[model samples]
Target: MSTVTTRTVAYPADGLTMIGHLALPAGDDRRPAVLVGPEGPGLNDFQRGRAESLAELGYVALAFDINGGRWFTDPGEMLARVTPLLADPDRMRDIGHAALDVLLAEPRTDPDRIAAVGYGTGGAIALELGRDGVDLRAIGTVNALTTGRPGEAARIRCPVWAGVGSEDPIMPPAQREAFTAEIEAAGVDWRLVVYGGALHAFHHPPVDQAVVPGVGYHPRHARRAWRDVVDLLDECVPVPG
Candidate 1:
């Protein structure tokens, strides 16, 4: 079994409590750290599972919640809940920046080697954080709706890997193509994976509700995305001393 710790971190004077799950490498040493952002406003079991899996791979990982403890079971409900927060990019950056501060303060985390991975909406936030000049080493996002933010792409300092499904409507081909071009223009090392016949939330293994008639889960893409996440971390975040 992997070792893990659940902690509550308060954002800087924001009066909102963010829940985080930290998974430590076996036998203890300051290790490279990853902040795994959940897809919804709050976190879910799949996000926690990713953290545990990362710990199994010998990196310190933290799965964080954007909203304080509330989560929506349905997609519509989730959109209604996070719409306001999503509209405000500055607030979104604050949320990520605060989390980075907390992670940097962790004694067991290697401040020099920090990266972030996010799924769906959370991936959008990770992109914002990366684009806002947060000192990340690597960034990996899965099934995200790519949006434009001013000066965001130019500020990214690390390698980026983005995954998208060919069948996902939320992230259409045109949008991903445009986003890829923007990323390339920023002069940052980046890779884009277009998975065949998969839908949104491909990395969320336990998500059972089908958003459409015939598309839901793709285990192959999910597993491959997990491996890609690991590879990105290994490339960007060095093992702690």
Candidate 2:
């Protein structure tokens, strides 16, 4: 196995310091990069692990903290910070663009092969990044709904893959159908995988019910989801020469 290294990078965003955890292969080859956005507010352990896993797969992965260390589960705080960003398309675009720039500037990363992955709230940001013409090789989202004006799907330029739980109440069957129709209408390549008997937050196995109040995971789906993500990365962001 190739050596792996993890580091903390501080990048400027909105005049504030945004801390990100970056993982990369230790060789001289400039590998493709993946930018991971967190689910709710700030950086978490799960996102960090994702970066490490990506690095192990021969890619330079940066897990960006969009919330700038601020997180709130309470309805009021959620509305004040997360909801507004979700409602406004421009804010999400700016945040994603800034982080993409930071990752692109990394010497060990391949800018052209970059991709984005997010969970829940972070997933929505990833969707917006693709919708805003990031030129990403591919985009992956876990348990996120359509965001930033319904018709924004027409702006996507890369293949998109979404993983959702069949039992997730928030992402009901009807909602999934609407999301699919819009993406299909946009003429972008997209796929939605619904894991049977799984609830929200299925990717993080150990964290199924610990972090989020209502989410419990399905072990089988979690394993399969990880494989699917790795396969997507392998296909879209091949190792550099």
Candidate 3:
């Protein structure tokens, strides 16, 4: 197994001090990079561990912070903070861009080979980054099947993958169809995976705090989603030897 090192990174975004977590693989060689975004609750141990796991797979990974590093234990608090951000795509882009800059500035990241993966509200931010025409190799989102402003997906220059729970009321079948239609119309390469019997935030591990009505943890689907994201990276952003 390759050694992985991690560190806390502080940056400015959305008029707040954003704290991100960066993980790097053991070696001097530059490698492909992945930008990870956490769900509405904000950057937690799960998301930070994801960056480290990606580093183990030979990619430099950054788990960017949202909400100025504040995590919510109450469902209402999480929604209240994330709802407005979801309504504003430009704000989401600003947060994502700040994190992207952090990843790009890393000495070990191969700027040309980069991907973005996010969960829930973070997933929407990843999609927005693609719409904003960031030079990403690929974009993978989970539980954020939200559509962007009309005709904006055409600007995306890379493939996109979205994963969602079949029973997720927050991202129901109608929303998923609309997201697919928009991407397809724009001629963007995209794929959507629906995990059976799962609910919103199924990719997340169990939390001790109260969650929203439709939110539940599915360990199996969570592992599957992680594998899918890794597969997307392996296909679109291969690390150079």
Candidate 4:
């Protein structure tokens, strides 16, 4: 892994000061950039580590925050915030664009080569960006099978890849089918990977805070999901030699 430099970035969105984590690789040249979104709980260490990991891979990465730097361990509190946020696509786009702006502000970021990867509600935000017509090289999400509104997916300008656990009650087979049908009908290039025997949030490491029902960690699948996201990035926006 390359030496990575990280810093805190504060930006405003959704009437709050969003504290984001920016990670840069050990280089001066501009490189492909990525926006990393956290799960519904908030932008915690796991997500920040993901940003650093991406930077080590030679990409500028920003692990953005929601909830103004609060990580909600209470399942009810998390759902209270995320449930409404998910229903409002415009708000999700606002949050995503705010983070994208932060990522773009970094000198190491190559504006032309950008991608968005998010987990859970964070993934929903990335999808909102694509649906809002952002010129993304790729959009990858885990445990987020959110489908766009009617005719909204037609605006997505890049390929989208989503990963889910086969047994995820939150994103059951029927919901997955609907999501796929929506995107396919809009002529979008998309693929969905379902990890067998896994539950919801299979990509996240187990948290000692609170046990959110239907959510569990699968170490093997988590690693595989990360590799899959990296593959999507490499395929869509390769680093310059």
CA lDDT of each prediction against the hidden true structure: 0.77, 0.80, 0.93, 0.93
Q: What is the lDDT of residue 155 in candidate 1?
A: 92
| TM-score of every prediction relative to native | 0.90, 0.90, 0.98, 0.98
For all candidates, the clash counts are 0, 0, 0, 0
- Summarize candidate 3's per-residue lDDT along 1-241 as a digit string, tens digits: 4499999999999999999999999998899999999999999999899999999989999999999989999878988999999999999999999999999999998989999999998899999999999999999999998899999999999999999999999999999999999999999999999999999999888878985788899999989999999999989998765
Report the C-alpha lDDT of model 1 over 1-241, residue by residue, as the tens digit.
4356545555541357777666777665688888888886468777777888887776778877787756676767777766777777787788778777777877888888889898876787788898888888898988765765754698999999999888888788898988888888888798999889998776565555426443367899888888888888877885644
Off by over 4 Å in 2: 14-16, 71-80, 205-213
lDDT at position 27, candidate 4: 68
- lDDT by residue for model 2 (147-235), tens: 45666788888888899999988788997998888899889898899999888777765532225545776788988987887888788
Q: Whose lDDT is greatest here? A: 3
Give the C-alpha miss distance for residue 140 in model 1, angstroms.
0.3
Runs with alpha carbons beyond 4 Å of true place in candidate 3: none
What would the TM-score be for candidate 1 when compared with the true structure?
0.90
Q: After the best TM-score superposition of candidate 1, give how far the Cα of residue 226 lies from its true spot, in angstroms.
A: 0.7
**Which pairs clash in model 4?**
none
